[model samples]
Target: MTVTDQTAAVTTAPEIDSEQLRAVLEYYFDQDWTDGLPVMPVTESSLAAFLASTDRDPEEILFTIGHLNRSLSVRSAAINAALAGCKPEYFPVVLAAWEAIAKEPHPARGIWQSTTGTAPFLLVNGPVRTELEINSAGNIFGSGFRANATIGRAIRLGCINVFGLHPHKLDQATQGNPSKYTAVIGENEEQSPWPSFAVEHGYAEGDSVATMFVIRSVVHIEARHTMVPEQLALDFVNTITRSGALIHEYTSTLLVLVPEHAELFANAGWSKDDLRTFIFDNATRPRAELAAVGKDALSNRTRWRLPSDHPDSTPDTASTTDEPDTVRLLSHPSSVQIVVAGADNAGVSAVVEIFTLNPPREIPFSSSRIG
Candidate 1:
C-alpha cells in the first residue's frame, strides 16, 4: 500500500465515551504513548481544528523513519499537536519544525535517538513570535508560556508515538537532558541590536520561520563584570571551546545573547559577523590540553581541512604553518549562530552545542516558513 493509505489506516480510531474520557491520561500512559506527563486528550474535533490550520493535505507524508519503516503524515502530526495541548494556530509551527528535521542530510543518522541526549531546539522568527505570544525575554527557556511549551512537546510526542524512540529502547542517551521535555524560544527582535536570525539566514523580515537544531548541551555564561564587548566575547569563547566538550571537529554552536550582552556588543560596534569571526579565530585550545582531557585521539581522528571560506582555513602550499600545536573548536565562522534573547536585567548568555554525527560536512539546518 502507498504511504498515504498506510497512514490513514492506522490514524483512524473510534471516539471514546465520556466515561472513558475521564481516564484518558491513564489510558494513554498505559499505552506508553505519553511523555510521562499529563497530555491533553486528542479528540476528533480538536484534531480536525489542527488539520484545518495547515494547507497541506492531511494524508501528505512529511517524512519517514528509515530504520523503523514508519512514516509521519500531516494528519498524524496534527493528532500529536492536539495531544500536546497546542492551539490550532500553533500547529503550523510544529509542522515547520518537522519540516526542518526532514531536511537533515542524513535522516538515517537517527539524531533523535542519539546517545548524547540531544533535544530539538527551536528558534522561531518573524511576526509569529508576537502573534503566538512565544516568550522571547526573561526566563525565556523556563516554563510559563503555552506556545513555547506545547509546540515543543508536540514534536517529542510524535517521536514517541510515531517513531517508537522511547527511552532505553531506540533512544540510548547515557544521561538525558531536561530540555528534552520542551525547548522552543523566539528571538527578541524588538530589543535586538542586530538583524533577526531568520533574516540573517535570508528569510524575509515579514515571514514566520521555524529553524530546528539538535542541541547536545546548554552552557550558561554569566559575565556581569565586563563592559568591553571583546571581554564578553572571550567569556563565551571560553565556554564554547571547553576541552571536554570538544568531542569532534565538526561541532557547531548557537550563541544566545541576552539583551544586556547584545547591547554591549552593539555599543562597541561589533556586528554578529565580527563576533563570529572573533570566536572562530580565538576559540582554540593547545594540542596538549586535548591530550590532558583524553580527547587527543578523537580530535586527531576527526580533524580535517576546513573549507577555503572558513576564517581559519590555511593554504595548501603553506599547510605546515597551520598551528600544529593548536586545535580550533569551530570549523567555520558560519557555524556560530548568534541571536538576541532573554531579559535585559543581567549580563548573561548561553552557548548551545549543536549535536552532529560528524557528517562529512557542516550539517544543514532547515528553515520552514510558518503559514
Candidate 2:
C-alpha cells in the first residue's frame, strides 16, 4: 500500500496483538521503515507491561486526542511506547506529555500528525530529572539514557501507529529537525535554588512528568557574572531574537538561565513579565531590513504565509514596531517565555531558548497532585 502522507491515509486502529505487531513489523521492513534504527514491534503483552508500570488505571482516558481526528486509548499508547522500548517507569511522564500536547490550543493533533516535519520534545522539570536519571547537562540531547531516548520515539510511534501520522505528507517539514529523533530534558529544580518548571506553572515541586511539543533548534544564551542584569538581558535578547523569533503567532522560550545569570535578572528586579515586555519592545526590525536576512517570509506579500502561508500574519515584532528606524533592540514580548535552569557555576549562567513557534507550552513539568 502506498501511504502518501500522514493525513492522506486514515485507518481505524485494529486490535493490536502479537500477531498484528509482527505483521506491521514485517511490512515496515518490506517498506524499509527506519530513522537510523530498526523499530521494535508493538505487541499486546509488551504494551500491557508498560501500562502495568504506571499507577493510573489502564482504562483512564488520559486524552481524547484530536491530532489525527481520532481519540487514543491508553492501551494503544502503552503498546506503542513498549514497542519503542520505553521503560515502564517512563509511563507517567509519557501520559503527562500526551495530556499537555492534547490541550486545545497546543495543537498536538495538527503538529503531531501533520506532514510539517514537526516532532514532539519532552521538557522535564522538577526534581524527577535526577530520579529518572534524565540527562540535562552535557550531551543531554544525545544517546546514553533510555528515558531520554525511547520516550520520544514511543510518542512518535504512537502518532504514527495510532493516528497514522506520517512523514513527508502530513509532516511537510522543510528540514525535519533533529528533535524528531532526539529528546530534550534537564536537571530537576531541586538541584538549583530557583523554582522548577512546575512551580513556575503554579504546580508544586517534586512532581514527576514531561511536557511535550514540536520545536526548532534550541539556542544557548550565556551570561557570565561579568554582565549585570541590563547587560544580561541585552545579551539574551540579541542572542535569541536573531534566531527567527519574529514571525510565529506564539513561540514559547525555554529560558535556561544558569543560576548566576538568573540572579542578575533577579537583582535587577526583572520579573518574567518584565523580561517579556523588554524583549517584545526591543526584538523589532524594520520590514525593509528584515527581508535582507532571508526573512522574505515576513514580507508584506508573504506575511500571512507565516500562520497559514497566506501573507497576512504580522511581521516580527521588531520589523512591525521599528519600521522607521534601526534602533531595533528586539520586539514582541509575547515571543519570550523565561524559565530558570542550569548548573550553579561561579562565573556564568545560560538562557537556552528553543527557537520557533512549535515549542512546548509554559506549564512546568509536574504531574497534578490531585490524582
Candidate 3:
C-alpha cells in the first residue's frame, strides 16, 4: 500500500478518550466544538508517515513542555502535524522547534497554559519556508495560506492536546496577543539584497529550518515616499517598541522588515547589524513607561541584590541583570532579532514579529545526521 493509503487507513480510526471528553465538556459548557463535532483522533499510522519523512527516528524525544510534561516523540509530533494538515516535509521543522523549546528552560509549560502570555510563536526560516510554501508575504499572517497556517496550528495542537495546556488549566493568557494562531514566519533576505533573519542567528545564508519563540504581538511601520530610508527604519523600530515591547525587559524580539521598507534600507546600504543595533538601541521605553504599561518588574534589571558581591562586571548593567545580580537576559545589543519580508510595492513598510528571547540562533541548521 502507498504511504498515503496506509496513513489514511489508520487516521480514520473512531476513538476519542471518553475521560478527556468528560473533563473538557464539564469545564467549557459552550466550548468551541459541539457534542459530536470533535477533532480527529490522533492515530499512530499517520504519525509514522510523518516520522518517515524526517531523518530522526520515530521514538526520538524532541522536547517536553507544559503541565503534562508530555514528551514530544517524533511519532507523536508527526501525528500532530498530520492533524494540522502539515506536509511530510514540515516534520523536520516541527521537530527542530521542539528541540529548540526543550533548550529554553524557562518552564514553557507555564507559558503554554498561562494566563499571562501565549505559547511560543513558531517562525520558519531557510529553504523549508518555500519547500513547504509558508506565507511570508503580503497575506503572511492573515490566514488562507496552508503552510502559513497548519505548521503553526500543529505546534499549537500539540501543546493543547498532547501537552495538556488548556486555557485556565495551564495557559494563563490574560490578553494574549492574536499572533498565537498566526504563522509569523519570515521570508529569506537572499530573495532580496538583505541577509536572512536566521543568518543573524548564525545559520548560513542558505540553510532551511524553523524558529520558535514566545511572541506577545506584532505591528507594522507604514512609511511613504516622504520618509527617507533611515527615517523609515527608525520609525519602524519606534512604532513596535512601545508598550507591549517592554512588558518584560528579557524578551527576544523577531522583527519582520517588509520588502517596501527593506528596499529603502538596501538602497542606502544598511547592513543587517546596522538595522539590528539601531532598533535595539533606540527601541527603548523608559523605566517609567514600562511600569505604566503594567510591567512593574521592568526596573528589576541590574538591581539584583546578589549576596553583596558575587563577582561584578557587565552583570551590573540594569538591562541584563536580574534579582540577586543574576544575568538572565542578554547584557548587550546582541539581544534583538530582525528579518526583512512583505510586499515590495509599499516602498517603506515592515511587519515586525516580536519574541521574548532574541530567538532561535542555533547555528548551522541541523542536517540529517541519519536519515
Candidate 4:
C-alpha cells in the first residue's frame, strides 16, 4: 500500500452530534476548510459504514495526484464521502468517480487551479442511476436531489482534503459556476431512443459506470421549434459556433439532450455518430470571424503538447476574400459526446466544454465502473 507523506493513519475521526456540530462547522469555516456549505460530520460510525461499502483496503492508495504530489487513500475517500452526506450504497460510485478523475490526461492540480473556474462534471450510467435515484430530468442540474448533489460534492471534498486543492487558496476559480458545488447528471436511458452512454463508451449494457470530465462551462440550449433532425442539430452547432474557440489537440465536448430532443434524431433514423459528424461539420466559423475575435494566431501551450497536425496548429491565414475561410469548432467527430438525459423538457440541452487551455488540452474524459 504505497502512500504519500500526507497520508494519515486509519483512525476514527472525532464525533460531533447536532448539539456540537454547529461549533465544529464554524471552526472548519474559520479555517477555510469547507466549500461554503455546512458539511455532515464524518463520525466513527459513518466512516466505518462508508468503508464497509467498498472491498478495497482502507490504507490502500488509489492514485498519487501528480500536480499536488498527494496520495489519495481509500480511507481518505470514505472519510470525505461520509462528510459529503453520501449513503453507504453510494460509496462505489464515489470511488469509481475518483478513479476516473485519476485517469484523466491533465493533471488535477492545474485543472483545479485554473482561472476559468472549472470542475468535474459527472455522468452516471446503467441501473445504478435508478438504484441511487440520481436526477436525469427537470431541474436535474439544479437543486433538490441528494444522489446528484452529494456524490458530486464528495469528489470536490476529496480534492480539497486528500489532494489539497482548497478553494480560494490552491483551487482558484474566478467566478466559479454553480456546477462547482455539484454537477452530476444521469442519462435518462430508460426513455432514451438510443443506447446508454456506458455502451457508447465500451462498457457492457448493464454495467455501472461513471464518466468524469473537467468542465469549464456548460452552455444551455433551448430549441423548442426544432421538429426536424437538421433543425435540432443546427441549433446545437449555432451555439457551438458562438462559443469561445479553444480548439486543442484533444477537444472533447458534451451534448446533453433530453429524450424529447433525441427523439427527433431517432425518428430520422440518425445514429449518435451521425449527430457527432453533423455537429463537427457545422460547428465552425470563418477564419475571418476568429481573427475578428482575436483568435487568428492562438496556439495551445499546455504541457501535454499537441501534434503539429492539429487543424488549428497553423495561423488562420486564408485570404479575407478566399471563400470565407472556415474553421471547424471540434477537432474531430468523436470529440462530440452525446448523452440523452432530462425529462419533460423536450428541446432542452447543454454543451459542456472541457476546461479550455492555451494548448487546448485539459483532462481527457475518463470513465470507470462503479463496482
Candidate 5:
C-alpha cells in the first residue's frame, strides 16, 4: 500500500495489546512529544479515516508551520487529529482551523512563541456546532464535553507534534493560562438577539464557519446586577480598558457576552454595531498611565489594521505621553467585537485579549468555512 506522509503511515503496523499501548504512552512522554497529557495513540486506520473525511488528497500540502520549518500535509494533520482523540467527522473543522492559523495574517508563529502563553480561541458557528455537540452553554469553556475537549486538544497537539512548540523549546510562555489545554466554544445563535457571528462575517446565515483568535487571556465579567445597557456598557468598558490593560497600538479584543447580558443591549435598541460603538467610545486609558506602565516604550511603529479605520489614517500614537489626555483603547468600534454566547441564566461575559509581540503589533483573526 502506498503511504502519503511518513508520520501517518506506519511502515510495519504494530498490533499492540493493552501492555504495548501503555508502553507507547510512556515512550511518547519520554520523548517529550505530549502536551503533558496522555494522547490517544495515532493508528493507520484512524489516520485514514480522518483523511477520507476531507475532500482533499492525503498528500496535498495543507500548510507549512514556519516556526518549526515543517510543511504540514493532510495526512500529517490527520495523524495529529487522531492523536488528539478527534472524531473523524471533526477532521474537516480541524483542517479549516489549521489552515487559518497557518496564514501570516493569523500570526500563529508569534502566538506560539510569545511569553504571554497565548492559545487559540476557536468559535464555531452553524450546524457544525450542534452536529459536533460543542458546548455553547453553561461551563462552555470548562471540561466535561468530549467535542469541546478533544477538538481544542487536536489543535494543541498540532502545535506540539507538527509545529514543534513544546515548552522551553519554541513555546516560551510564562505563567500560561488554562486555555492552553482546550479553549473552544460554539456561538449560542438560538439565544442571540442579533444575527449570528458567522452572518456578520459575510458568511451565509446557515453556513458553518470557524474563527480563530490568538488569545493571551480570558477575563470573565460578571454583570448579574446590571439590567440596563448603560450599566453593562460601562462594565465592559472598564474591564477592557482597565489600568494595566494590555491595549497596544494594534490590539483586537473579543467580548463574548452571555445571552442574558446581551439582552440588556438588545432591549435598549442597541444593534451589534451600536454596542461596539458604545464600548469603543467609552473604553479609554490615560496616555500617561499607559506610558507609566511602559506601554509607550513597548509600542511599535506598525499600524494596527482596525476594521473601521483605514491603516494609513491611524497615526502612530505610541510615543504620546500626555498625562491628562485619554488615549482610546480601541482604534475603531470594530476592534472590539461582540459575540453572543454562553447560557442565558447568568450574566457572565468574557474579555478575550489577543496576543501581541510588544505594543503596536498586529495579530490577525482568520475565519474558515466548514462544510
Candidate 6:
C-alpha cells in the first residue's frame, strides 16, 4: 500500500514550530513520547530525509506486536529514528535490525513482554560498519559513537512510542540494565582471524547484515594473566555456567572476543569452531550444584521428569540414563556464538547471556541483510 493510504489511520500531531527545539521536546515529553531524554524534533524535512534513504514504502509494515495489535511501519520507524537523533543514512540499518527481530518465531511472547529485562543486542557486520563509523574497538559497548548509540535508541523508542511498552506498564522489567537504553557494536572483521559473523551465517562476504539477540545480562571476563587459549576458554566457561546465570539448560551465550583475546586463540591454531567445542565440552555443572542456588526442585520437575497422565506434560522429560550427573549449560556447541570485536589492547571479553525463560527449544538467532 502507498504511504498516504496506509498512514490514514495514524494519528497526526498538532503543528509545532520546527525552529523551536525546546517547545518540540516539551511537546513530546508531555505526550509521554520521549524516553526520559531530549529527543530531536520530528520535522518534515528530517522525516523526508529518513524516508528517502530507504526504497521501502513509507507505510510498509515492519512488524506487529500481535497481542497489542500495534504494527510499526517504515514511516513510523523513520519517525522514531529521527527522534533518536539518527542520521538519515543510518535508516537502512535500523530497518534491517527491526526486520531481524520481526523474523523471530514469537517476538511478542519471547522478546517484548519478557520480565527478565531482556533488550535487543544488535551486531552490525560488513562494510556498513566502516561506512557509518560504527565502533568496533576500544570500549565498543561504551558511549561515543553516534551511529551505534542512535540506532539502538531508535529500537527502544519504537518499543515505547509505537507499542506502549512503557516501564511499570507493559514492560515489566524487574531491574533493567544499562543496555536497555542502547547496545550495538560492529564486528571487528578487519582485525579478526576468521570471517565476519554474517559470512559464517551464510550471507555473502560483501553483504552488510544486522543480527539481533535478546539478552538478559552481560558479564565481562578478564583474563590478563594468561596467554593460554584453554585458560581463557575456562574463564569464559566459568562465567557462562555461573550459578546465578545458569537459569536453563538451553541457554545461549554470545562470546564477544577482543582482538587480543582472538589473537591468542588464533596463535594456538584454534578456529571459532574449536573454541565453541571446547566451551560446550567444559561448560557444565553437576546437577547437585542447582541445590546451592535453590533450583534443584525446579530442574527436577521441569527437565528431569518423566511423562505421565498429566495434561500439561513438558517435552523435556529425560530417561534415567539420559539424566547425566553433570548438566550442560548450553544445548549445543553452536549455542556459544563467537564474534571478534573491540581494540587489540585489552585481554578482556564479554559473555552476553541470552533470554531463556522459555527453554528446551531452539533459540532463534535472527539476521537480515542491510540495504
Every model: Cα RMSD to truth: 9.3, 9.9, 8.7, 8.8, 8.5, 8.5
How well does each candidate superpose onto the true structure, as a TM-score? 0.88, 0.71, 0.72, 0.86, 0.85, 0.88
- CA lDDT of every candidate: 0.82, 0.58, 0.58, 0.77, 0.76, 0.83
In model 5, which runs have C-alpha deviations exceeding 4 angstroms?
A: 1-17, 291-324, 356-363
- In the predicted model 4, the residue pairs found to clash are 300-358, 300-359, 301-358, 301-359
Off by over 4 Å in 6: 1-19, 297-319, 356-363
Clashes of each: 0, 35, 20, 4, 0, 0
Better of 3 and 6 by lDDT: 6
For candidate 2, write residues 64-132 as lDDT tens digits.
555356666677668767767777777776777777666534344365544435566677776667767
Q: At residue 128, what lDDT does model 3 achieve?
A: 69
RMSD of 3: 8.7
Residue-wise C-alpha lDDT for candidate 5, range 257-305, written one tens digit per residue: 9998888888889999998888878877765665565453332244432
Better of 1 and 5 by lDDT: 1
What lDDT, from 0 to 1, does candidate 3 have? 0.58
What's model 5's lDDT at 67? 54
* Full-model lDDT, candidate 4: 0.77
Report the error of model 5 at residue 256, Å. 0.6
lDDT (10s digit) by residue, model 6, range 199-316: 9989999999999988888888988999898999999999988887755545678999998999899999999999999998997776567555654333445443222334433333
Model 4 segments beyond 4 Å from truth? Answer: 1-19, 243-251, 300-324, 355-363
How many Å off is the CA of 186 in candidate 2? 3.0
User: What's model 1's lDDT at 152?
Assistant: 94
